[model samples]
Target: MRYPSKSALLFIAAGALSTGASAHMGTDLHSHGSFMTGLLHPLGGLDHLLAMLAVGVWSAVSARRAGPALLWGPLAFANMLVLGALLGLRGMGGAVVEPMVAASVLALGLLVLTRQGMNAAASMVLVGGFAVFHGLAHGAELAATGDAVAPVAGMFVTTIALHLSGVALGWSLRAANVWATRATGAAVATSGLALLMQLA
Candidate 1:
């Protein structure tokens, strides 16, 4: 299994630093950078990051028209997440949301790594369904922060970029070797476990 090349790790590190810098400069959920913070919130956590990337990697492993669907799946998730936040904002639902999101991560990662011969369409439907949990989490956080549109927009774009980057890397690795893909799936599942632990 290829660990993230030093360069890739370094790149992620740099991106994290950039987000931290932006966040500290008043982009937290409370203030000026609320929107930006909302976008970065997903990447800011390990569970969400790995689960989202795993979605793409798992999608590519299946035998369908994987590329466009893989990209669209996460985007759809983010969109729905915003809608969920709106729901939360209106005081409709609360609690257990993050746990469900983490559970989706665990389930999807396990599916991608262990299940074989499942149809590609099935995988798409499964992952897309899980994405709603993720989207709601994003939306709920954004709604709570009450940041203006611009900051949230900034955060949204940055996060989508991270998801796409994960998808691209996952696809590239899958092209290189099947084991690499399996290894990624395992790592992603492990991350889901970690998220569950935190919640517990």
Candidate 2:
């Protein structure tokens, strides 16, 4: 039987630690500590990192207008994500935020495997929605610690970097195997399912 690699298990362990750290920080948003905490928040979580990377990979895999889609899709998602985080911080919603996030991973993976490129406006809408969810997830943690601006900016930069990493990873793999793209999609979808299970 195939098992998750050692690195994968380590990733899971790290994510749990980060989540605990965020929760325990307890609504503090101005300490210099929050900056580093916020910066690592996205990278620490497997769900967040994979989903963000998948956005880029999927964008690149599309047969149509791959360039802008790869760049813009994640950007739109990130912008809206920040907005969602603001809402969460304000206590505007229930704490059951993980479901929505898991759904995004599953949806984005399927979308990449299935959808052809749409017109520019529709494309923006698609990417923007995902970005909002991603941002909100990250943003929700912000209410717990450090200087909001620094941590947020750090996360934003990290988010962009991760997307770019995904794009690069996808592009590199694309050259070697025709199936590489779909494999990434599958990996993403599987990861989402795992996250959902953990959340449950």
Candidate 2: lDDT over CA atoms?
A: 0.61
Clashing pairs in 1: 35-151, 35-152, 36-151, 39-155, 81-135, 81-136, 85-139, 85-140
TM-score of each: 0.71, 0.75
Task: Give the lDDT of residue 159 in candidate 1.
Answer: 55
Q: Give the total clashing residue pairs for model 2.
A: 13
Off by over 4 Å in 1: 1-30, 63-67, 115-124
lDDT scores of the candidates, listed in order: 0.57, 0.61
Using lDDT, give the best candidate's number.
2
Identify the leading candidate in terms of TM-score. 2
Model 2 TM: 0.75
